[model samples]
Target: MIRLSRCAWPGERGAAAGVRRPKAAYNRGMSRNGRIIVAMSGGVDSSVAACLLKEQGYECIGVFLRVGAAPAAATDESGTQSCEVPAAADAGAAPRPRLRHGCCSATDAIDARAVAGRLGIRFYALNFEADFERIIDYFVDEYAAARTPNPCVMCNVHLKFGKLLRYADAMDAEFIATGHYARIRRDAAGNATLARARNLAKDQSYVLFGVQRSALPRCVFPLGEFEDKRHVRALAAGLGLRVHDKPDSQEICFVPDNDYKELLRRRRPEALRAGDIRDTSGRVVGRHEGVANFTIGQRRSLGIALGRPVYVTSLNVVSNTVTIGERDDLLAGGLVAQRVNWLTDPPARGCDVATDIKIRHMHTPAAGRIRRRDDEAVEVRFDEPQSAVTPGQAAVFYQGEDCLGGGWIQEAR
Candidate 1:
C-alpha cells in the first residue's frame, strides 16, 4: 500500500519522511489540523494551486498521480527461449508503444518533482494506476458500447473525492484541493453548493456533478476565483514555478493523444468487433468497422459517401449497427436522464421554471422544461428541438451559473 498521505509545510520536504515541527499556522491544531495536498499533474493550473496554498500560510504539499503502467524506455529485450548464444545477443527487441496523451507517467513524475522543488514544496508521486485503469478502462468500454461514460465524473467522485479523501484522512490532513475551475460556496441554508467558475469558459462543474454531498466540505478549488487563465499563468510565473508556461491539458487526461480508438483497441479488442451501418428502418446500408468509433451527430470519415450528407443518429450494440439519417431526422424535442445528482432538493416535476440545461460540456445551454417521468428520469423539453439527443449523454440543469443538478440521458424522442 502507498499509504496515500498528505504533506505538512511546503518547504518542509521531509514531513512524510517523518519530521515533526513547532506550532505555526502550518502546524495549528497539531493532530486536528493537517496539511493541504494539491493534486499536481505537472501542469500550470495545479502548480499555481500549491503556490497559493503556501502563500496563505498553510502547510502544503504537491503530488502527481501516476495512472498507467510504466512504459518501457526503449524496448522489451526478454527472450522466450535460450539458445547457444544465450538469446541475449540475437534476441530482437519489441518496439515500445507510442505514449498517449493524458495521465501521468514516470516521465511526468520527474517533471512534477522538479516543479515542486522550484515552488519550495514537498513533493511525491502516488500510484493510482490501478484505480484509473478500473475507472477509465470501463469508461472507454462503455463508450464503445455506445454509452457516453464520463470518466472525469467518476474520477472526481470515486478517486479524487473517495480515495483521495481517504488518503487525506490517513495523512491527518484537513482538506484536499485541486485546480478545478469551479467555485464552492455555502448557501444561506449553510449547504455547500457547486457554482460556476469565475472563468465561464473554463467552468468544470458539469463533470463534477458526481461529487458526494459529504465530500464537498473537505475540498477546495483555488483557481476558481481567478476569472482568466492569463492571471493564473502570471501567478505561477510570479512564484517562479517550473510549470508556469506549460500548456493546459484540454483533452481528457487519460486520452491525451486524442486517439481513443487506439486506446479501445488496446484495452478491449473484443468490443471492437465489426458492426453494420443501418438506416432508420433497420435496413443495412453498409458495413462499419465498429460501433465504437462512432458517436451521434458524426458525419465525416463515416466511410460512406451517399450523394446527400448523412449523420449518425443512434448506435445499437446488440445489433452492432450505427443508424444514420438526414440532418432534419436528428432533431429531438425531449430527453430523459438517470443517476441524477441535485445541488438543491430535487426539482418539482412540472415546475416550468426558467432554467438552462446543457446536454454536453461543449454545448451551450438551451432553455428547457422539466417534468417527471414514470421512472428516475425527467423529461426535458427543449424550447427548440435539439439535434442528436443521443442516449447515455449527461443533461446538466442549471439556474444561471448555479448547478441545480443533472442526470444521464437514457432516451431522446
Candidate 2:
C-alpha cells in the first residue's frame, strides 16, 4: 500500500496545523475492513483514535493498560474501588476505585469502557504489574548509579509494543494502535520504520525508539497525522465523547506530585545517605543529604554560598562525591551509547553515519556523527560540544524526519 493520502507524506513532519474532517470511508458504520486494538488511556487522544478507527470502518477493540496505581486514599478502605489494582485476582478484595488522574486507576478503565460502549466495541483491562515493577526498578537503579532514566522508553519497549502485541494476537487482532503522536511508514524495500509526528510539539517518537523493529508492522498511530491536538478533541466532541475536555496526565504515574526523592527514600534508601559536595579541585565545600537529590547541571539547592556560581558537573556514586565547577565544565564533546536497537539496517562498525542525536525528550536534535562502535554500541561525536549529556537518558538518532534507532547514554566525555 502506498499511502492513504499524499497529505500523509514525510516532508511536512513539523508543518503547521490544518483543519480535518474525517474521510467518508471512515464515517460509515457498516464496514469492518480491518481489525485493530486501540490502547485507550481515557485521555482525549486515545479516545479519539478508537472513535476515528470505528468511524473509518475498522472493527476496533478498546484495551486499557494498567501500568501504575494511585494513592491508597484515592480508593476505599475495604479495598473495594481501590486505586491500585492488585497483581493477581482476589475474591475478597475490593475493586479498583475511580481515580481522578487517569494513569492506571479504575477511572481510566471506566472512561475507556464508556467510549467502547458508545462505539459499540469490546473493552478489556489487562494487568502488567510485574512488567511495571521492572520499570520502577530501572528508574531507582539509574538514580542510585548517578544516572538519569527514561521509564517511558522501557515501558514502550517491554509493555505497549511488546506485551500488548502478544495480547492482540490472543484476540486475533491484526494491529495494536496507540494514541502516540508518531507515525509508522515503510521504505522502498517495504521495511516498516518510525517517523516523527506532524505535531512537533507532541511527538512521542523519542520515548518509543526502544520499540522492536519486528513489532513495527503490528503498530498503528491514529493521531500521527494531526498537527493540531485540538482537532482531535473537536472530533471527539462531535462523536459525543465525555473525555473531550479531560486534562492530560502531566506527571509520571509512579512519581506523582513530582517527588522522586520521596519515592527513592522509600524504595532505595541506600542511595540517599549523607554525602560530600566537592569543588572541581577535589576539596569538600559542603555536605548534602544524598546523591539522589542532585543531577547534572544543577546550579541550586547545594546549601553552599561558593562566592561564584557553580554547577554540578558530575556524580561519582562509588565515592559518594558530587563535583561542582564553572558552567563550561558541564559541556561534553561526545558520548558513547550502548544497547543499541536499529529500526533500520545499522551502518557497519567504524562507519560514521551522519545523524541528529536527540539527548532528551525536549532538547533539539543536534547534528552529530554516529560511529558504529560494535554490534551493540555506537559513539556519537557532536558537531559542537553538547551540554549536560547525562547518563541513563535516551540518545535517539534521526535523519530528517526518519528515526534511525536509539540507545541508552552510558558514557559522556
Best by lDDT: 2
Instruction: Give the least accurate 10-residue stretch of model 2, judged by summed lDDT.
Output: 1-10
Q: Return model 1's CA RMSD, one decimal.
A: 10.2
lDDT of 2 by residue, 1-413 (tens): 11111121112432223546433312222223377878887778888787667756677888777765433423222222223332322211233443545266566666776666666776666656667999999999889889988888998899889888877776667788889989888555656789998889999999999999998867778788888888877665555456767778776788867789898999999899888999888999999888888888889888899799999999989889888999999999899999998988899888889999999999889999999875669899999999999988989999999899999999897
Candidate 2 to truth, TM: 0.84
- The whole-model C-alpha lDDT of candidate 1 against the native structure comes to 0.69
RMSD of every prediction: 10.2, 8.1
lDDT of 1 by residue, 1-413 (tens): 11112323323432222222211212223224547767877677776666666666567766666676543222111211111100111001221232444646444465566656655666655556677888877778787778867777788788888877776766667778888888777655646777888779998888887787666766778778777777676554444444556666656777756778888888877778787888888888888888888889999988887788999998888988899999988999878878887766776675655668888877788898886555657778899999988776788888877888788888887
Give per-model TM-scores. Answer: 0.81, 0.84
* C-alpha lDDT (0 to 100) for residue 240 of candidate 2: 48
